[model samples]
Target: MLKLAVCVSGGGTNLQAIMDAIDNGTITNARIEVVISNNKNAYALERAKKHGIQSVCISPKDYESREAFNQNFLAKLDSYQVDLVVLAGFLVVIPEAMIKSYRNRIINIHPSLIPSFCGTGYYGLKVHEGVLNRGVKVTGATVHFVDEGTDTGPIILQKAVEVKQDDTPEVLQRRVMEQAEWIIMPKAIDLIANGRVTVSDGHVRIHE
Candidate 1:
């Protein structure tokens, strides 16, 4: 069985999707061992508690530097014996130490189709706003390995959602979550947990 850890910084809609997938047996051989959050008030923690999953809140303010925070965070993951780390609405840039230690073991879900309205400043509704501002006919979500660069990791899966006229950022965000993010993130997790995904030559190939 694969021990899973989820990190979050906001409302855990993506976290919920993962849990739902696991509950429905869509993701086999994996169990969410812990849910970690940088914000104590984050609703993701509450979701974890509701499901009886172990929850940890590690405030960055408690640590002096990013390296210190990463060390403590890595310790928690190690203590849990986590095999996979999922960033579900986690906002902070993952530190180099954690990135290096986890490597392809960490995955994240980005709101917009990556290489588009993504990277440093693109998150939450800002991504949807950017897509609308650019007048893109379609936008979606990307699940990728967590690399040092922001959302620049090798893509695992992408599902596109139509951008409708008169759509507000909030509306588009919801649509993308329902149509894309919620679908592919869990599927990507399933593929990884089941040993069906391989990363080679800076790309991912899923076995049939």
Candidate 2:
């Protein structure tokens, strides 16, 4: 089985989606082995505990430097023998070492249809606000393999949500998240788990 380690920094709705997918057999041949969070009080930890999964808190504040924190974080993940790393609402800028170690094996769910309103400062409702403010006709979610750049990873899946004329940030965000949890995330993981995805020339190709 492909063992997955999920990292989170918030409420963990996306992590819940992954858990539901695993329980429903949508992600066959894989299991979520651990859920790690950088926030000690993040609700994701409680969610993991409820599901009887291993929950760990490796706050950056606990270490002397960013490198040390990342080292400890990677060590914990390595101890679990994690095959895939999923960043579900995780907020930290991943260290270069972790990025090098996981490479294409790490995946993240962005709140926007990326290469659009995404980067170092764009996250959560901020992305939705940017999309709505830009007067774009459509915006949605992206699930992609993690790379060195912020949300610039090879795209694995995207689901678009039409932006209504009167849509507020909260409204658009709720709608986007609905599609995110139900569509993009599951499809991305399935592609990776089934070996249908490959990264080349900065793009992810889904092979038949």
> Quick one: best lDDT, which candidate?
1
Model 1, span 1-208: residue lDDT tens: 8889999999899999999999999888899999999999999999999999999998878999878887887887789889899999887778888888888999999888879999888989999999999999999999999888888889999999999999999999999999999999999999998899999988999998
TM-score of each: 0.97, 0.96
State residue 194's C-alpha deviation in candidate 1, in Å.
Answer: 1.0
Cα distance off (Å), candidate 2, residue 94: 0.5
Q: Write one digit per residue (lDDT tens) for candidate 2, span 90-157.
A: 99888888899988999999888788999988998899889887899988888998989999889988
Q: After superposition, how far is residue 202 of candidate 2 from its true place, in Å?
A: 1.7
Q: How much is the lDDT of residue 67 in candidate 1? A: 81
